[model samples]
Target: MTQTFDPPPPDVVLDPEREASLRTIGVISYALHAVVAIGALLPGVQASIVLLIVAVIVDLVKRDEAVGTWQATHFSWRLRSVLWCGILYVVTIPLWFLFVIPGWIAWCLISIWFLYRIVRGWLAMNDRRPMPR
Candidate 1:
């Protein structure tokens, strides 16, 4: 017998409250990323590290509830995507310490990628079909 796979329906509707929460999280994450990028350009490694720590804290708070909701709703793939993006960003930081300019560029690219994934997943979660890639 042959088996077929079907995409699960969205677990949560995009109400005004959820939309507001998503926008808030997006803004916070973007701001934290911007600060980290700018801090990397400064003289000391301490600034970059401090900014990175702040970013991580912000990330944890922002995603904690969302992760729980996703798990409870069986949207585990979305959670995995978010987690992978975080991991990629973390791995790129030390590289920035080695070769400043190139590392910063790479970091920026990775940051953009993270934002893309977050927005994409958010849309997917809400069952909003994103535009073509």
Candidate 2:
């Protein structure tokens, strides 16, 4: 879906509460991203899909609050990122046993792509820059 975000006006002034909420969202986003990244590397906490669902819930809930702001862009990007990871994983399911080598390669590539997405978005947020459309 082509999502639309209305960023607050350039001259818009945020109240303390709104600022705090934005910060909270950023931290939560990072935590969610970190969980998936770490989970992939560590077998014990391999609940990426579940964790992503929680994160998506947070994103959906706060998305409206970020209307017209960079945070909206983040929510949009992250939701898609998680889904892409899920897609990649699902696509490799059949190949996992029949084509073990290719499946492993695909998994590794997906992991790298996932990490890139998370890190790229995190860095952009740190710089207070808007996510790409």
Candidate 2: worst 10 consecutive residues by lDDT?
Answer: 41-50
lDDT of 2 by residue, 37-129 (tens): 767755466755677678889888888887777677888888888888889899898878899889878887887788788888888788777
Q: Over all chains combined, what TM-score does candidate 1 have?
A: 0.42
Model 2 whole-model lDDT (C-alpha atoms): 0.78
lDDT of each: 0.51, 0.78
Summing lDDT over every window of 10 consecutive residues in candidate 1, give the lowest-scoring window. 68-77
For model 2, the stretches where C-alpha displacement exceeds 4 angstroms are: 1-7, 10-12, 43-48
RMSD of each: 7.4, 3.5
Off by over 4 Å in 1: 1-8, 42-48, 67-133
Query: lDDT tens string, model 1, 1-133?
Result: 5533333246744567865675565455545554554444445632455654565565555654544243222133333444675687688788778888877787667656655655554554446332222
